[model samples]
Target: MAESQLLCMEDGLMPTAVPESRPQFYYSEQHRAALERLITGGDGAFKSLLKDENGQDFLSAREITAITSSFVKYKTDEENGGASAGQDKRDDAGSLHSTYWPQMSDTEVPPLDIGWPSSGLFKGVTRVAVHTHPPKDNGPHIKEVVRKLIQESSKVVAIVMDLLTDLQILRDLFEASKRGVPIYIVLDEPGAPHFLDMCNRLQVGARDLQNIRTRTVKGIGLNLSVGRIPGNVQSKYMLIDGDKVMFGTYSFSWSSSRMDRNMITVMSGQVVDFYDNDFRELYAISDKLDLFKQFHMTKPQTGTLSRAAVPKRPAAATSRFQVNLGDVTRGDGKVPAHKYHNPKYLLALGQIPGPTEPLQDFFNKMEPPDPETEQELENPTEELENLTPDPSPPEKKKSKKLKLSFKSKRGKKDKKSDEVIEENPANPSDEASKHTLTRDETQDSLKKKNTECMCVIA
Candidate 1:
């Protein structure tokens, strides 16, 4: 047999198990309606993490118990008569009540009266309007109010939370900048990076516009240095044209209006001036967020000695001893034993020399003698006699005498003449007589010689 095919399977006979899907927790229609009501109501400040994208409350079991506890507390408070019950609801309900329905302390000033009215002339009727979110059913939206404020105002000063991804609000601010309205924004230091990034993106967009003269857009970082307490600039407000002021828990962001519960109050009066003044003071003190300063660490300045006025001490004892010995040796080494039996040495330290002769007289006294110049100075008459001129003229050299002889041709009678001629070889005329005569003079002399020969021949 094949084991009877009907083997009793213990696990198969247990049960046909169907896997359970993740238990879907959703808000009821009543719960959704209540949340909307709560948001629209004065309890709009209550932050909710229960609501989903489809407007459904996906509260966990623990969250539901927390919500139930809140309802129970609300019922108890209603039975007792709300805030007038004089009971500390925060203490009674613990974290739930404290988070959802925080009790306003007596000392806490309302956001609307942040600025007090100054003592000045009330010229015109001060217009005032209060707006809260989730906004009232009949009134203007908070976003629209902000847009209108930005569009109409000549200048805007604001302090707000992190300017996150809020295109509509950022676009309105950019438009305000394009209109040449000076906008001064002060942000908490932590949110400064995000706010600066948003401003850079806005600037990049503004670059494309033609002839669009943009106004001054300045930002400042608020330094809240409190230990481990997570200090932040929690004050959210705006001052327009120093005349109108809008302030509240509201933020300049889309999530603040659409998701987060906040409030804003628009007021125009002498009171606004006070807020404007406060903003100016705060803005003046706020620091600028420079990336180079934040990241590029700098070394602390070290103190240096001044070269111009350095203190110098007197010479050392050994050097002073050597200097004194040298000074003593420069003069006579013999000690004056008669003046002092113990031979006390006289130190000339710090002593100024007494004024004696003038510099010229001293130089004259020290001048050295010149032997030749002294001799000339002592016998001036002998020098003059040596320099005088001689009276007799010099004699000239004697000239030499030369004898000349003349011989006649054989046809004529021979003649010899003895003549004595005083000749000086050194004289110019005697030197000329030794040279050859001119051709004309030679011919005339020859003719005269021939005539004399003819006479001789005749």
Candidate 2:
């Protein structure tokens, strides 16, 4: 009978023998106590359940809520004689109470509720995660997020950005392209060159060339007929397989990671649909240049000059002289000549003619030297010495003078000369006159000498 009742429950049919009292659907004290402990433990208990056997935390919010609902349904099923009914022939009330309110140690509690919607907007997606830059939580770095998206994507990868200067991200995209994954990129016109260069590098040895396609948007396609001026498409976002999206103010540039203060969120499910749609719209108006054809096109011969072929110089006029030849001369008697004329023949062969007579005369009349120049002439020797280098060596030695001495052996000859000189000293008046001259006589002698010297100079 219990087996039949269990089969009926599985088939979604009510059993024939109903309980006298309505079975309680609410939690017992033991169940409530176990749930309280799980919640109080914060995310520790929840994390254990969310993590897979490999320890990867891939549980979504909706999956967590589903786990909680399953636990409640399982307890209710046992009360309806579901799980232990085939074991033994036990009293109904005792079995039902044991099944509905089991000991906390015996019954395992569910993990914390993740509070995710099970089925709403996006279909087929079972997981969704959000991360911010300058991160609020210990989430994956933006670069890692990008790499994972490209690595896990199966069908297509779409990216839209105003700037993309990150080399690592570019390499990831290149790698994805090599895997034959279709990649669509919409970038600002200025950044289009960078992305295209990366694509070109990947295509070098590739057999399938259509895996990557790129288009350039002008200011993120925001310029609405203001004469086609490039606009600022400042958005930075990427969509993976039309199901996952990673977006924020964080740009796909090196500086954006290390220098700029920005944010990015990695998420999946319904929200991704909106971003994917936006990416497609932006890509539609993008400037789609065929990179394969452009890079492979036959280039013009580079070594040769590109100038147009020279036209044969018009045949020289048959006759040198013409009726209108004189008309070409100007009023000053100057005739127009061909551009090929030698410049040497343009002017007279001799020295240029001087100024007219009155002008020449005016220049010839000399002006006095400036006062400064006249002062400089006052000390011409010093000025000349200053101008020229001295011939004397800087460190020349002085010559010594020779000293002469008379010896005592010549005493007799010296005494004889002294005696002759002493005799004049014996005559006092003659001695005095020989030693001294009067002041008036000295003056008269000096005047006579000056007059004689003057006559010689004249």
Candidate 3:
């Protein structure tokens, strides 16, 4: 199921002779067993990822909203002294429970209604927070709401990153740690090549602050998928301390802060315990450990400054439009064939390297024909026909329009027309003379020998 998380560059559009080889990756059985055991045992670490029994390692957007709202509601209720039991609960009951306590002792108390509330679970959570450093100043309400959690308690401060450095945020977090406040940093994985330099820079910051716990994303599997069915799944998220997490399109950098529109949600408590475990697992294999420890001592790689600045425009976001086997087979469990209809994406697939091709360069090489150059290549068919010989006649039925001569009119005029005339001349007298004359003489001869006219055009 974890294998389904791979991004399939092959959409079954390429020729059948060449099969696209998927990226080879190995999953740690130890990790899988650990995850399963943790969840089954109701360990706090299990909740960090917010996955189901199927191992789908993501919470939907609605789930995120619900979880944050649950924390908010619980905190609000706690403030009003109605966190658990209300004194007015008996008012709604028609029967007087106080007098019926003796009868209730003999009877079961309706088993306490073990159903999940529409409001969802709201226990073991004290605050909600959100943070982002998007390219724009939009989504202020989300930021403010998350900040409210911080103002409510000194122990809990939901840091919503409006416009700040990710490294600086971590530095401040280290300060908060000394003061005994738990902090978490959430940001996207810097996957694209364009962001590698920025990441290298932030990693320098990670190196500077030895006191603070810092991690840079090494890899994300989204590997919580079911079986080996490749499909479009999650790609962006980071959780800090189970309580402070960020999930969205933005990454941890100046570009993500100033150029991309993004969102983050922070909810603390058991939820953090759940999300934090998933994060720590991925972070363990990442280079961030080295980066955070080294800080300013390390300079950007040789090409970081030499390369051109990344354009401020958001990269063209791509979406996968997968054709599900289930839909075509109708629960038959057969792998249904699908066509890659998107021309742009299909072209991208062709460029990706399999075992034979380096996938990254293949995609990068995909170029759309320039409209101007395409127009220049367009020439009329008549011009081409005039330049080359006509197609050979069909053996069964030859074309009536087939030309007998390859040369132009002037070149073939005398020999071909004269030969035709020799075979079937308009006048026998003109044939006998054979010698051509000037205009008047030719006119007189033509008038004298005007028996018939057999010009091809006529």
Candidate 4:
């Protein structure tokens, strides 16, 4: 089919291509062998990642609450001597369980019961096995279960996922493809680029690509609309050989496997067909060429991909809207004086919050400093030095001169004499500074001053 025909239309929705017969879950000796393979022998890619620090996992939000509340309830019953076991105890916050998690949302919700099979919602998916992080009840690890499912699939494997960065899973899938098992993957449009990049890095050639068929969700994924907003393919599930299925919050990405506390439930029998139909529907809607086209669009080297692997914002791309003409003067683009400060004029706050009249810089500008004060302030150090009093003792005799000896260093041990003169108390800073000079320095300064005094005052 042409790639353009795959684009969802407003009126013409393509009918889903269904299998001739509903897939049958035949439990033969092969099923037991697969179970044995799952338990005993399998590839260790999943195990290799689990030991890394980034692979650490924890309980889901609701699970933590459930465990904590159960502990609290048991403790309360113990304290009441088993009398409060039958009585209801409500937590002060709201529900019977304490709010262990603040603003806690149940992202990994437990499978809800489907009205005991009579409500037309239940499917006989009884061969269920679950694995969570922390490995409860000596159950197999999450990665082990995923590896086993893919390892055991005898015929076809279809996976519809959002993200696929896990290399170990890719290796497992590659090995499965080598076993003549045709793999069909329908990925989300948003995350298609990363998966395509990974495939490039792994050196997957044309033949491998042909065997491992991959497609990305195209325009208006779930609904038709006149707007440009694209649909997000958020479904995460896998169908094994058309007869067994696995569905969960556990993403096919590394972060979901390692850092997250996600869970996957694998089932066999009647329910697999329902999920198989859903997978077929998803596969029918996805397009192979659209995946590559989007990859070229969202990749940096191929194109100008911005953060989040999307195009630059409309304002950022257009120079006209992105121009930052200041409030005082907007270059080239000038606003009429009448438009501003009038009923028609409205100032933008640069998209910042907390704008008010008192906080405006225009109304509260600082006044200019006095010119005389500005000049005086320039020589602040000299003024401060003048203001300080001399620490030396007062004169015993009726003389204004302050006599002081300063030792000077000159080649070994040569003595030097300094000239003295009458000192004015008004010029205390000059005399105070002179007190700090060494012998030779003091002598030179005093001699120069004496010569000047002798020449000018005589």
Candidate 5:
């Protein structure tokens, strides 16, 4: 005989019953064993049992969150060039790449035609200025850069701001002047700080022999800014020797040196001609230097020159650019204005010379890729292979399993019929209890019948 306790016999042995299938919890001893191995052999050895077969590092979010957080702080430090103090120590070796590296699409090295070398490979550029903002302390490097510019082509140098006689630039001006280099000095307004500085330096100081030969170009224009836009003020730009252009943002001053990121691109090429013509028009007005001295010193002038002068067009009429501005709303509730499209500029572009044929023809003639640039995306089949290692094809998730049950269909139908018959009361003949046995029960039944008979006769 089997034991009275519910014995779930399986495979000829009594097995303990269990609830619906679920994963078993690890015992305290098992957890301690794993932890001991981790402490003794380091995580790598202990991780073998816990890894999902492929040996990839499996770190919980909580374990690696602190490390990932440092990247954000590292990025912030690099953008401001360490200008901000109190950044994380880990990011001290910040990189400039996040800010300065140009995009592939935007990386166009325009041809250095008109004596401006636009080829991507240049040893580098040599830049000389009255003052190089983002100044370098290495005078040798400065000299080298200046020598290269001068040796390369017709080097035109400009004295931006007022030509201060006492400033160190005047020394350079003196040297270049003696060297017979055509240096153009473009001055700001007469009463401006630059204007006053030039006056004090020249009047209170001894006659610099260079001033006799130094040529001045009087300018009427706004300042230049780098990596920033001014509040609706247009800046004036000048081309020196058709090599580079200097566009001013702030009034050239001592305050502008280390305090601001103001700068000018020492660019080369046909671009230089664009700035050269601008200087020419301003120089054209300097012929009346007497009038400049008198009119600027508050003496009343009688001529049309007293009125604000309209700036001259830098490019010739056919090549002139027209600007189109658009308003873009930013996330901070500010509407930033930007250049949308310049139709006139597009018209000028249409005139630019391309390789002797239409754009379609040029594209059709392009050769196939130089295999070095072609990178293949991974194969989906290979990725699937790695994911599945069951030694057999996936079982299709058993979409709908069919099982053989011991209970017959007829048994189910009979059970359902029995339930319905019990729920509804059956006829007396079919009642399970057919009669009442006690005498007191029979007397009560007769009394109820007599009362009914009396009520019917009445």
Candidate 6:
């Protein structure tokens, strides 16, 4: 019975009255003993295990997964220029990876042992947990770990991540920062826009950034990386309170954990010493991120610009135009002005260019209409042909008056000066030049006009 205890049996051996009638065998112990010998007995042991019962051994899912992970880690190490780290510790970075080795951060860690100096891997593992996520799931397991780490942190918190836009994780960090624990964060420079926007959405004030210091890092990890992009920070690890380290492929952003497979390992021991030092070096080499200066955030402008100098269009004309549009179809068959009849309104609305001026000055830089060809502002339908003209366009010279809507070199003129151009037809180009508007002047005039129009309608 004592020997049988070694086996992981869900159900115990059956009790029997004739215990000594037949010999009892603990086959599990024998199998365990044989497997232990095979692992310790060198290459010859594996040869025997591989050729069992006239058959060849085949790799399981676990073996295939391990091989895939190994290849991925190997490629990542090569990119960081620490590919030989597993072979020789003295050659380059032993385990930690960096662009500037040794100086960037000391690659040396506590020597591997069975006690406290188990080289940051584990010491009795204090606590061990494993989690897996399927496609299209939140994968809240790793998130809970990080939230708890920040919540329980006392001394300091440092995070070096490629991206850090997780709302829940950022809120946890905000709370930790409020508790007066100095939080140091390093993110990729390429993700600055999203990081700043995240802070703003969380209502994190600019002044609060003083407690939660941040920096952005760019460029490939090593100089020898030929085709690597210069926009990624790539490293993902966190050192908490100087004793615990949580490091893995788990991203605190929109990808990885939730949308793909990732792993996070948390360990507490003297192991965190190397990561703490590494974080300090990463922080030193990175550039400071000022939310205010980086995003150009400021108080939104309040008041509108002064429109005293802008000539206001007639308010009565607006009312008349609305009455025509509102009651045209309802009452005794009234009609709004046709598009062709009002050249000034068409010019302002960008339907057509005026004879004296191109609309590129006032509108969205539309090319001027051909001077010889007349632009049809609207389709000439049966009803449109009957609509009368608005007062915006010029009337016949023999009528009551010719309105000069633009300012003149002679200053503000009464009705008498309005007919000066039509009565004295000296130089049409020279007369038109007096009223020609610069782009800036036209924009200002339109802005003021649009403001009043929007107020009355909106």
Which candidate has the top score in lDDT?
A: 6
Stretches of candidate 2 above 4 Å error? 1-128, 197-209, 220-228, 297-458
lDDT tens string, model 2, 110-226?
A: 211211112235445546566655556677776677778888877777788877767777777767767867777778877777766755665543333446666777652111111
| lDDT score for residue 424 of model 3 | 18
User: What is the Cα-based lDDT of residue 336 in candidate 4?
Assistant: 36
Query: Which residue pairs collide in model 5, if any?
Result: 112-116, 112-118, 156-241, 223-248, 223-249, 224-248, 224-249, 225-249
TM-score of 4: 0.36
RMSD of each: 34.1, 33.6, 30.0, 30.5, 46.9, 30.3
TM-score of 5: 0.26
User: Candidate 6 — which pairs collide?
Assistant: none
Better structure of 2 and 3 per lDDT: 2
Score each candidate by Cα lDDT. 0.48, 0.52, 0.38, 0.54, 0.38, 0.55
User: In every candidate, how many clashes are there?
Assistant: 0, 1, 25, 0, 8, 0
* Model 1 residue 125 lDDT score: 60
Report the Cα lDDT for residue 405, model 6. 33
Instruction: Give the candidate order by descending lDDT.
Output: 6, 4, 2, 1, 5, 3
Candidate 5's residue-wise lDDT over 409-458, tens digit each? Answer: 33343221100011112332443553322334434543453333221110
What's the C-alpha lDDT at position 287 in model 5? 34
Candidate 1, 363-410: lDDT as tens digits: 465545434333332345632332222232334212233233333444
lDDT of 3 by residue, 1-458 (tens): 34422323347543222222434434434345544444344345555533443454444556434433322111343467663344345545554545433633453322111111121244375476455544135545433433333333334222222222445443444455445554433223333233234445544343233323333443233232221111222434444322455455544444555566667665655565545445444434433333332334543332344776886632322223443333333432222112233455445443321234344555476666444323431235522333333456466232222232233334455543221111212343463554433334533533332333222331
Provide the lowest-lDDT 10-residue window in model 6: 109-118
Inter-residue clash pairs, candidate 1? none
Write down the lDDT that model 2 would get: 0.52
- Candidate 1 vs candidate 4: the TM-score winner is 4
Clash count in backbone of candidate 4: 0
lDDT of 1: 0.48
Where does the lowest 10-residue lDDT sum fall in candidate 5?
Answer: 416-425
Candidate with more favorable, higher lDDT: 1 or 6: 6
Model 5 whole-model lDDT (C-alpha atoms): 0.38
Predicted candidate 4 versus true structure: per-residue lDDT over 162-209, tens digit per residue: 888788888888888777688778888778888877776776544344
